[model samples]
Target: MLETHGLTANYGQFRALFGVDITVAAGECVAIIGANGAGKSTLMRSIAGVIRNAAAMVVHRGEPIGALSSAEIMKRGIAMVPEGRRLFASLTVEENLLIGGQARKAPGPWSLDAVYQLFPVLRERRKSPGTALSGGQQQMVAIGRALMSNPELLLCDEISLGLAPVVIRDIYAALPKIREGGAAIVVVEQDIGKALAVADRVYCMMEGRVTLVSKAAEVTRRQIHAAYFGEAA
Candidate 1:
């Protein structure tokens, strides 16, 4: 449902992406894996409209949306759980989830109860300030907040960063439910194991380009290592 064609992006003159092409089909889970500075996050930002590109660069269902504002892209059914889980510090936990749905309220399956169901702790701490929560809780809030938008495509950037293995597992365990709710997911992750466990397809990037793309079961560890570091076996 989302695609990029010859997508190139730049911050002023320093180019970050080189003819990057990727695709995420409806209800499929795609994982993007790479090391730091490999342009994984850059690609996510470009697709989310945080970094503007030429009209022909990014496409949503065959329409050029590269130049659209982030809000515009969001309205077209794309939502992002950014790298930092940028929740409003002043808002309550429940309030954060509420705001995610503000942009497009013509909901399909996500609601406050559903979010709470996904992460039960969120319901118990619904009134607490978002920043007051633990890191795991905050991450849960971030994921729930994105789901509140009822988006067709969900972009998860570094969702496992700085979290414990069990916590990451818990977060990923919710993926089946999210997929059941009908959203395509693009997970940008550094933890290869977690990404491979949940992804139907995986793409490994290195130095601003995709070096490997394969079905999750089809890729070997050696290939992943090579793609991740741009190294030879």
Candidate 2:
């Protein structure tokens, strides 16, 4: 339900994305995989409105929302779990999630209890400071906070960046439930296998360009290797 057409982004004079084109259909999960400096996060930010662009660059459903402020974007039903799991250090886990619900009161199935059910540990840690939780727990809070918004489209940037494998598996296990709620998801992940496992389609990028786009089940390791690093596999 989201599309990026000839999207480009810049930080001052340094360009981060170059005519990047991608699309996410309703209720589907899409993965973007690339190494550091590959602009995956930039693409996510551009769509999330952290980096603005031409009016037609980013579209949702059928509307052009390229220049909307982040708050406006959220109100329109897109919520982002930023790359760093940027939780409010002062707020408790429950309070942090409450902020998300307050931001966008859209009607959906993602309530506080629903989020807790998706990540049970979050309920147990509800009274703890958001940042005081373990890395994986913190990540759950970030995701829960975004879900609390009851968004139509969710942009998750690096949700598995630095967690243990078991924890990562637990985190990824929640994707199906999310999609079952009828929200499309765009995940920016470095773990190619993990991304492929959860996504229906995948985009591989390198040096600010999309090198390959294919169905997750059909894209081969060799293709991903070449697309990711610009080298023969």
Candidate 3:
């Protein structure tokens, strides 16, 4: 469970997010969809504590964590698969995954074997350098790396970016298993169809604010189109 209230972030004088509010319940999957420069990633970074803000702005469960460091947030049961899938270039695939659990060693179902089960290809390429893998395999490694932490909340920023359609589908197919472990997920995605397919609810942002929040099954294409582009529709 996570909530953001009146959340705002700035890069010097230029503000990126303006009072963007959103919430994710335990085991719930929430997707954030927007065009480029819409602040979806900004909101993810803020929640992950990559961009510091007021202490009371972001809350995990019931405690404020806006000002906490990224490591602190990860320690508090939140792990992020960042937009670029920033895996360690020098580490082997298995080693990269090992680093994720090293930071916060908590007992859970996600272990090296569990991750390999989730992505069988990862098991085959366990000894390969992380950067040596294909984009899809690399993404799997990123997701697996995050899962190694056994987080209660998973922040996925652009998980589907730059992947082939079949690969994206393969990545999303792993979500049910992730949820089976009771981890709430926040997915920031540009692919509206994929986001809607995997999320229970969806939030659409424009500029720096949430313009629409609706159940994935209930929101229509016209509504999302309007919300995405700031159009009257």
- What digit string (tens of lDDT, one per residue) describes model 1 on residues 1-233? 88899998888889899999999999999999998999999999999999998978898998999999999988888999999899899999999999998867666799999999999999999999999998989999999988998999999999989998889889999988999999999999988998999999999998899999999989999999888888884
Write the residue-wise lDDT of candidate 3 on 1-233 in tens digits.
Answer: 78999999999999999999999999999999999999999999999889999989999889999999999999988999998899999999999999988867878889999999999999999999999999999999999999999999999999989999999999999998899988899999988998999899999999999999999999999999999888886
How displaced is residue 158 in candidate 1, in Å?
A: 0.3
Superposed by TM-score, candidate 3 places the C-alpha of residue 225 at a distance from the truth, in angstroms, of 0.9
lDDT of candidate 2 over 1-233, digit per residue (tens):
89999999999999999999999998999999999999999999999999989989999989999999999999999999998899999999999999999988778999999999999999999999999999999999999999999999999999999999999999999999999998899999988989999999999999999999999999999999999889875
Pairs clashing in candidate 1? none
TM-score for all models, in order of appearance: 0.98, 0.98, 0.98
Q: RMSD of each candidate?
A: 1.0, 1.0, 0.8
- Estimate the lDDT of model 2: 0.94
Query: Which residue segments of model 3 deviate by more than 4 Å?
Result: none
**CA lDDT, candidate 2, residue 67:** 98
Per-residue error at 133 for model 1, in Å?
0.1
Taken over the whole model, the C-alpha lDDT of each candidate is 0.92, 0.94, 0.93
User: How many residue pairs clash per model?
Assistant: 0, 1, 0
Model 1 misplaced stretches (Cα beyond 4 Å): none
